[model samples]
Target: MTTLPAVSQHNPWTTLGAEVRYENNWIRVVENDVINPAGNPGIYGVVHFKGVAIGVLPIDAEGCVHLVGQYRYSLEAYSWEMPEGGGSPSVSPVEEAKRELREETGLLARQWRELLRIHTSNSICDEHGVIYIAWDMDQTESEPEDTEDLIIIRMPFARVVDLVLDGAITDAMTVAAVLKAQLLAERGQLPEDVAKLMLGR
Candidate 1:
């Protein structure tokens, strides 16, 4: 298992605060103040995040995985990624996953399994992303949010691994989720018992 290095050793900086300089629906920039490990105080910089969420290898009735291609303003282009979101104050992570899946791909799963909790960027942000595995999915009409413009693509389960190896899919959380699901499936532990419990089956 790969673990992030301790903050104290990874960066020679301790944050004091990030004053918001600008804010918008898509992004926000902040000016930060920090004290370097060498005991030198100086002005630093970082983005204040509103957080994000990601779903793992989703398995459909035909044993296919669903992926989405959407434009990422930060990246300045479209990229293939799993269904994800920033989560709503009114919904739990699980609910958010379901919503994102339907919104982005017009799919709904009968079962959902949590894969892991990952920090998208731990160095200077408060963003924590939760990964989940969705299976037994059924297709439905998409209900994308007003801000979303996504295209859905379904690929063979085997092809997902190939995409990762070929560098076609580069989103860290998506990669982690797919790898984790593969690991679990190989060990005969896929769709963990807890997930069955969630589905009341």
Candidate 2:
């Protein structure tokens, strides 16, 4: 009988204590006192999110997608992305995605599929998010929040994927969703109609 080496699955960092360094309604920053994976003393600061992030990519029957444009406060730059919003822990992510899509693009989708889950900045923050694909859409008046000054544009799905590849779309969720959508369409993994629309087949 041959003996195999045992692979350890235990966490290497040992947390001795934690303290909240800052907090707000949206996030809490905690500084942790810990012994490092290399057995050295160190501290780690983590930003804990108070809610989940939700994003929706709505594809119309004409093979176009709606993108929302706005200036991001943190980035101090304008961004073009799919409909996105924060989701409360008490609410369903799908429901939240629907609300965001409606508020940002005024489109209601009869069909929705979860596309992906992501952590925006895993090295520093615990901001988890859900991305969705919504089709069979109906247009309505957008109900953007008072704080939102939004611009909506409709473009071919393939063009949007090109924008992502060309570095024009930098929003993490939007980039991930669009690329995933493109791959799905190429692989014939999406619904036949939707895939056809995406690939212009």
Candidate 3:
């Protein structure tokens, strides 16, 4: 059985004070003095995101999924995963997904569907991530942002699943979306055309 959220909500933690520790174009960090749920006084630092994160898993007609590789500043390493970016909270998540897909791979998907909604690091950050599956695309030249240096690759969707299982792809959104897509295929939950395309490869 599943338990859903109640219509009424209550907050347990009480904040004594809050101060901004840092701010950037994308995120803001705040230090909050609070009384814990257990009645202890402590400080909690939180990273607040300014925009919603968007991720797109674009699979072509031949069952090839597009991946983007780039150097991650925070990790100081190169990561390969689904094409993803951030979108203004004012815009629809699906619209941002389309933009990210187009910017990273220059592919416009004819069909799009959401895959998952997640919070990347809820304990220390308030960042919302939305993952999507896109198919039946038209390919063209990529127009990456000036700050982005990306490498695009097209490979079998199954290979992406292998990478996920092998821990080679650790991006939260990518991991979730790829596994979800596989599960959907296994359970015959996807569209007849999309499922056949994914399972076929």
* Tens-digit lDDT string for candidate 3 (99-166): 88888899999898888899999999999999999998999888899978999988888888999999
Residue pairs with backbone overlap in model 1: none
Q: What lDDT tens digits, residue by residue, belong to model 2 across residues 65-149?
A: 9999999998999999999999998999999999999988889999998999999999889999999999999999999998799
lDDT of 2 at 84: 95
Against the unseen true structure, what C-alpha lDDT does each candidate score?
Answer: 0.75, 0.94, 0.92
Backbone clashes in model 2: 0
Weakest 10 consecutive residues of candidate 3 by summed lDDT: 4-13
Model 1 bad stretches (over 4 Å): 1-18, 25-28, 192-201
Better candidate number, 1 or 3, judged by TM-score = 3
Q: Give the TM-score of candidate 2.
A: 0.95
Ranking by TM-score: 2, 3, 1
Over the stretch 1-201, how does candidate 1's per-residue lDDT look in tens digits? 799866654765789887988888745777888898899888865666654655655777666778888888878977888887777545688888888788778887888778899987776666678888888778899888888888888887668877987998888888887777766666668655533322223
